[model samples]
Target: MIDTHTHLYSEQFNEDLAEVVERAKSQGVEKFFLPAIDSETHEKMLQLEAAYPNEMFAMMGLHPCSVQPDTWEQELALVKSYLDKRSFCAIGEIGIDLYWDKTTLDIQVQAFEQQIDWAIERDIPIVIHTRESFPETFEVLKRKKHPKLRGILHCFSGTLEDAQTAIDLGFLLGIGGVVTFKNGKIDRFLNEIPLENIVLETDSPYLAPVPHRGKRNESAYTSLVLGKLVDIYQKDFREIEEITTQNALRVFGMK
Candidate 1:
């Protein structure tokens, strides 16, 4: 399985990073896509990817929450510099987030649109982060629709209508541990969308599944997400694994 969006480099795992990766590998999670948060984490992310070259992949972007008025342009420029100098799996973890602070709404929109243009120009997929800004996000994507603008909506928690909108925009719904929550509404929407338009992710060390909820999340919990998918799709484990893995490979351009 592939963890499409994870922050293994986060200080949350500093105490047991090796064991976390080993546990994840033992559970068949062979690949991890690490999303960049800001310049402060760029080097650490690169270090993690270097340490596990075959298993860890990195993406470059300036997360909406990380964008301050003074730092937004510099961060975006740093993203552009990273993209030009190296190859990344996606232009990721970038989108509008009004949940934390509504004051940065305008700046977030500008940054999100700029990153979308960057991805389109480079012919690469993106990993989007949307929280309480689905309407705004959809508005931006709709206005700047491009055939090459394809990606996943990380940790999707939107409505069925929103899911369909993402699908219509050539985007996949990135399902994670949230589906296993007793109150997660994504399960209701999953039944409406085909498994083909879905991809598996852990978003670790963050949203651990069921039994591990509230604890530190890791890629090892990908199986829990997969197990939930099986229950939702009424398909076998192996089949769900194969199809989601294929979907991830297709989006990240991995073999």
Candidate 2:
């Protein structure tokens, strides 16, 4: 399995990074995709990837929550510089996040659009992080829709209509720990969305699945997310694993 989104570079794992990777690999998670938040953690992210070059891949982007009115442009410039310097798996976890502060919506939209253009120009995928701004996200996505634009909506927590719309817009819904939550309503309609339009992620150090909910999440818990999908889609574990791994590779253009 591929944990399509996780922050193994986070300080949360600084004490036992190797153990965490081994724990994840023990559960059959062969690859991990790391998303960049800002310049603050870029070196740590790169270092983690360096330690596990073949197993962990890094993405470059300015996360919405990091979009301060003062430093966003500088942060985006740094992102562009890195993209120009080398290649990354995607330009993400970038998108609007109104959950924290609604006042920065304009700049967040600017940053999101600019990063989307970067992904389109480079012909790479994007991993989006949308929180309390699906309508705003769709509006930008619809305007920038392109045959070359393809990616995942990381940690999807939206309505069924939003699911279909994202698929129509050339994106996959990234399923994660939330599906196991009693109130994570996506489970009610997830099976209705084809497995082809879905991929697996953990959003580690954030949304750990049931049994580990309210605790720090790790990549190993991706198996738990996959387990819930088995119940949701009523398919065999290996079958879901194969399909979702293929889905993730498809988004990353790996297979």
Candidate 3:
């Protein structure tokens, strides 16, 4: 399994990072994609990736909530510099967020649009984070539509219509710990959204699955998310694993 989005470099794991990775590996989670929040977190992310090498991948982008009018330009510049200097699995964890603050909507849109350009120019996929701004996020994607514009809607928690829209736009949905919640809601209709269009993710150190809910999320709990998918798809565990792993490979252009 691939945890398509996680912040393992996050300070919360400072003491038990290796133990967490070992636990995750024990569960057959072979890949961990780390999403960048901003220039500040890049070094730690790189350090963590260096520690794991091929097992962990890094993505470059500014999280929407981090898109402040004062620092966005410099932050994006730093992101661009890194993209030109190295390779990343995706241009991601980037999009508009109104859940936290609506004042930065305009700037968030700007940051999101420009980063879309970065992804297209680099010929890489861009992972999206749409928080209470799906319509606005979809609008940007619609206008920026291009053959090269493709990515996963990370932490996707939208309606069937939203899911279909993402599919129509050639995007994969990043399913994470949210699906396991009693109120996660995505599970009720996920069976209708073909397994081929979905990818597994933990978004860990954030949304831990049931049995571990309300606690610090870790990659190992991806099994819980996997189990839920097994129930939803009514397919063999191994089959669903291969399908979602392949979905991730297709999106990230990884083997």
Candidate 4:
């Protein structure tokens, strides 16, 4: 299985990073896509990818929450520099986050639009991070729509209507541990949308699945998510595994 979104470089795993990777690998999680947060994390992410070249892929972007007034442009330039040096799986973990601080809303929007343009110009996929800004995100994506534009709405927690809107815009819904939450509505939406447009993720070192909820998340728990999908679709595990894996491969251009 592939963990389409994860932060394996996060300091949260500093104490047991090796064990975490081993545990995840033992569970059949063979690939990990690491999303960049800011310049501070760039080298660490690169090192992690280098250490596990065959297993981890890195993405470049300036996270919305990481957008500071003084450093936004410089950080974006750094993203461009990284892109020029090496190809990334996606231009990602970038979007608006009004939940944390509404003050950075304007800057976040500008940064997100600029990154979207960058992705378009390069003909690469994106990994969007939208939180409490789905309408605003939709507005920006609507204005920037292109035939070649495609990506995933990472960690989607929006309504069914919103999911449909993203789908119409050529984006897939990135399903993760949130679906396993007792009250999470993701299962409801999954039942409505086609599984072909869904991809699996752990968003690890963050949203751990049930039985591990509120603890440090890791790719090893991705099976919990697969189990939830099975329950929601009432389908076989092999089918859920095959379809989601294929969806991830197609989005990330993996073989």
Model 3: per-residue lDDT, tens digit, 1-255? 988998999999999999999999999999999999987789999999999998999999999989998899999999999999998999989999999999999999999999999999989999999999999999999999999999899998999999999999999999999999889899999999999999988888998898888899999887888899999889999999999999999899986
Worst 10 residues of 2 by lDDT: 246-255
Q: What is the C-alpha RMSD of each candidate to the true structure, in Å?
A: 0.9, 0.5, 0.7, 0.9
TM-score, structure 3 vs. true = 0.99
- TM-score to native of every candidate shown: 0.98, 0.99, 0.99, 0.98
Q: What RMSD value applies to candidate 3?
A: 0.7
- After superposing candidate 3 on the true structure, give the runs of residues whose Cα lies further than 4 Å from its correct spot: none
The lDDT for every candidate, in the order shown, is: 0.92, 0.96, 0.93, 0.92
Ranking by TM-score: 2, 3, 1, 4
Against the true structure, whose lDDT is highest?
2
121-239 per-residue lDDT for model 4 (tens digits):
88889999999999999999999999878999999888999999999999999989999997877777678888998988999988888989999999998888899999998999889
How many clashes show up in model 3?
0
TM-score of candidate 1 against the unseen true structure: 0.98
Model 1 CA lDDT for position 91:
92
Clash-forming residue pairs, model 4: none
Worst 10 residues of 4 by lDDT: 182-191
RMSD of 1: 0.9
